[model samples]
Target: MLAGDGKPKHILEVNGLRKTFGGLTAVENLDLRLEYGELRCIIGPNGCGKTTLFNLITGNLKPTAGRVIFEGREITAWPVPEISRLGIYRKFQVPSVFEGLTVYENMRIPYFARMKPSILGRSSVSRNEHQEIMELLERVNLAGQAGELAGNLAHGQKQWLEIGMVLASRPRLMLLDEPTAGMTIAETKITADLVQEISESSNISVMVIEHDLGFVKEVARKITVMYKGSIFREGTYEEIQADKDIHDIYLGRHR
Candidate 1:
């Protein structure tokens, strides 16, 4: 739907999106479309507007101009909560949750949404919710610490909890940024498996922004390469890794 104005749309669409800040351009005339349940990755060098693009998508920052359509609705400039309520949940690079709350307590929190209200969500979900939560925890290998305080958990556990919190809301699209930051190789592999399970287990679309080529290649089905606030190229993981221009761009030869 188009906010208050009722309408349906393709899962997600960004047509000619543009964002400019005074002297600097963050995202310029960008066009992006997401199919239902597709796992898409976004990669770029520093200052290439990756986060800015995310901000625009999550309503953290408004684009200078563009049309943002989600599930057949217009949310180009919608606020965070509104966008979230519309089933587009987002996760940050850093973990977010009630540190003081135990894992059980954290999962017991209330649910918030404008549509499809399930009195029991991830925290306090019933059989289905509980099953999903348990599966997610186990999938990420965090079941052993389900009763521990969210703060008492390890760094990787904390990250998993934040992901669990987002799961509690049952979002249709997940925006993940550097989910494996500071993690070891084994941990990163585990997390990647969990992400894969999530994709295989549901119809949720994932738009991941990550820097590690190996990591992205592990989970990404398609990759969108960004530079200078616009898309440099989009292709398969192998295509991006072997791209001549990408190498030049990384070698400081592309301007």
Candidate 2:
């Protein structure tokens, strides 16, 4: 897709991305791009560098060589907070909600995290901000639990709460690492629909790293397969499932 000015419509572009830990290379010479509001899923065997790739893009780790461009600007090596401010948010494999706080209280933290130093207190929040938090909770199906402690939520509910908190920050892109991990089969299906709803209803580009083939098939419109520290293939779910090379990789015929 292109913009009115004829530029590429990609919301993020990663060119020649590489990361190495001393003699071990985790990621090597990778190229990726995502257009605005695209939902892309990545699947690979363990240690194939999926999480490492996410860390590089989110600034948790610096790339040995690469460029991360977001919204048409280079953001490689930017600090985590700065990158987040640029509208990129990452939801890790583990849920990171505020366990001691209520669902409503947890939503307030992201808002405060983005506040300018001059206005960084509870008094700075307006009534509209409170309503916004409630609305965000409602989007995640947590409206009735707004007063409940976050720690007491079911595993799936906690995951949804974290997603809602990320949405509160108004990210342009969201990297979700196995959002359905540890959920029951029913919960996994619900999460898949939730993610699809989020992507279609919001303006955020989404990238998910998931190992569950069933879940991936349910949620991913496009899938990128990684092997031996690089992207091995990219295609639709049917294409990937039928590819002999993918079968070989999974069967341990190819390393």
Candidate 3:
């Protein structure tokens, strides 16, 4: 696909994405694409293999058969860390912040540690990197609690911290799964706004998998509805929300 400028429309493209555990298939021959700097959402019912597809894309798990191309490069089955270092970061369904460390400490670890060369074990974080981390905490509204242990943060706050950690990688594409999963109404709204801001300010594409339709509607410019291990529909928020076929399949009303 190409935009009006005749440039490639998407930065990441997945063709024939599939995953199987023995004879059980989780994702089956799925195909989808994400444009640069686009905020897209994937929504589906439990056991629909949304996470499975994410893991495949991020190289946390290998696809049984597929091609994952990013920026005109083939990345199928690349190791997770290599894929991450290549500017792809995935936020898990559960918050993965370091529980024992303070918010500041958690963010700094990845910020500094990731800079170290894997083989040489050299680390370098400029003073500006340190300053930016503080700014990030403030932006996330957790600067006051930067001294508090990450284990003590509320569910939503931890979600924010995990997001901060992913930012430390300076990724071009971020895959966030259920970012507002355990948040309250207020926190959910706040998290959604933060994602919108990050996608805008960072100029990075973000593909989020969220169950809350209202939240997805708020954060996403485009929506990809998936079910039975395949795409059901793709469109703008209003288009998909009003799509009776999407609703029918999601509601068990589609055959």
Candidate 4:
């Protein structure tokens, strides 16, 4: 679908998405849309198929039904590597960094991944490439720790490093699964700010699935509430907060 000016209406569209394992349905006839550069949050109770949805979208697992459209093209059953090369990337709840490698070395992995020829065959990092690596480290507040082993970093720092690693790939759309999980309150707030900055400054669209209500309230401009494997409600933060049905199912009076 196109806008009035003829641009694509949404960068992503999931039509009637469904996923089942044996007798259980993880996701059920779900429909979702995301505009270019938009940030959306998905929230639901445990076992509500949040991770399953991410898996299906990223082609880590095949959908039982429906189509996933990206930039106006259908990519319902694309392979994982193909989907990733098309500028769709996902970061899981756990940090997937190379623990024994230095933070700089970890960043080098994805940076080289996007290049035509493998940099692994090269002897040393180019001057320009080194500058780019340092810049990404700075963005994640890890410039000072570039030489430190990733395994030595704190929990929150590891998460940030993983995010920086993904940023190196220069993805157009990012799927973050519980980015702030296991983070302290202060770290969560910092993550919220970083996510907002990434979207505004880099113009990358982001879809996040998080269980942290406080973090969601801080980062989400629009929130999608999922229930029983489908989108139950979608609106601005205030609208979602004021929704009685949402309150009853997910957010209690404490919210």
TM-score of each: 0.87, 0.94, 0.92, 0.95
| RMSD after CA superposition, every candidate | 4.3, 1.8, 2.5, 2.3
Lowest lDDT block of 10, candidate 4: 246-255
Q: Count the backbone clashes (under 3 Å) in each candidate.
A: 3, 0, 0, 0
- Candidate scoring better on lDDT of 2 and 4: 2
Tens-place lDDT per residue, model 2, 65-132, is 98999888899999998999898998988999989999988999888888888888555557989889
lDDT of every model, 2 decimals: 0.79, 0.90, 0.87, 0.90
lDDT of 3: 0.87
Which runs in model 2 stand beyond 4 Å of their true positions? 1-7, 123-125
Worst 10-residue lDDT window for candidate 1 reads 110-119
For model 1, how does the per-residue alpha-carbon lDDT over 1-255 read when each residue is reduced to its tens digit? 243455443478987888899989989988887777788888888888888888898899988988888888789899888998887877788887789988756654524332255533433346765676676667666778888988898887777777777776778999888788878877777778777878889778888888777688788689899888888999998898788999888777895
> Where does candidate 3 stray beyond 4 Å?
1-8, 117-126
| Of candidates 3 and 1, the better by lDDT | 3
lDDT of 1 at 158: 79
Candidate 3 residue lDDT tens string, 53-127:
999988999998989998768899999878887799889999988899888888887665565476335445468
